[model samples]
Target: MTVLLFGITKDIVGSSTLSLPVSSTSRLRTVGELKDYLSSTYPRLRNLSSLAVAVNNSYAEDSDKIDNFDEIALIPPVSGG
Candidate 1:
């Protein structure tokens, strides 16, 4: 699965996009699982107060299901006035 990173998430990951190997033995099925995997792989991600996941250009909840071909993006909290 490939995930697009935005704002601080991109800075933390050091890339605009991230690729996760999908195998029969280990497949990330839910959005929550993806978050855990990302946080584990990129410890800095865990520091963020809010990290939103978007699937196919739509906001997704923790319980949402994810597929390898899905369009995923990580949206970090934005503050401006």
Candidate 2:
């Protein structure tokens, strides 16, 4: 699957967009599950529980279904005044 990521998520995952070699039918259907997979792949993301997800430029929750063709975005933390 491919994901268009942003913010500190890039720092955690080490890329702005990512492509993996998992099975096409693999089911990582939720933001939480995606987090788990990401945490496993990028151990540095273990402490990123507060990060938010976006699919197709919209905010997504932990239970959101992420499909193979979907453009998932891993929007990480931001700081501003």
Best by TM-score: 1
Candidate number with greatest lDDT: 1
Candidate 1 residues 1-81, lDDT tens each?
889999999999999998877763157889999999889889999999999999999999999999999999999999999
Q: Relative to the true structure, how large is the alpha-carbon lDDT of every model?
A: 0.91, 0.77
Count of residue pairs whose backbone atoms collide, per candidate: 0, 0
TM-score of each: 0.94, 0.83
Q: List the residue pairs that clash in candidate 1.
A: none
Clashes of 1: 0
RMSD values, in order shown: 1.6, 1.9
Cα error, candidate 2, residue 50 (Å)? 1.3
Summarize candidate 2's per-residue lDDT along 1-81 as a digit string, tens digits.
Answer: 887778777867677889865673276877789878887878877776577888888898888887887778777677799
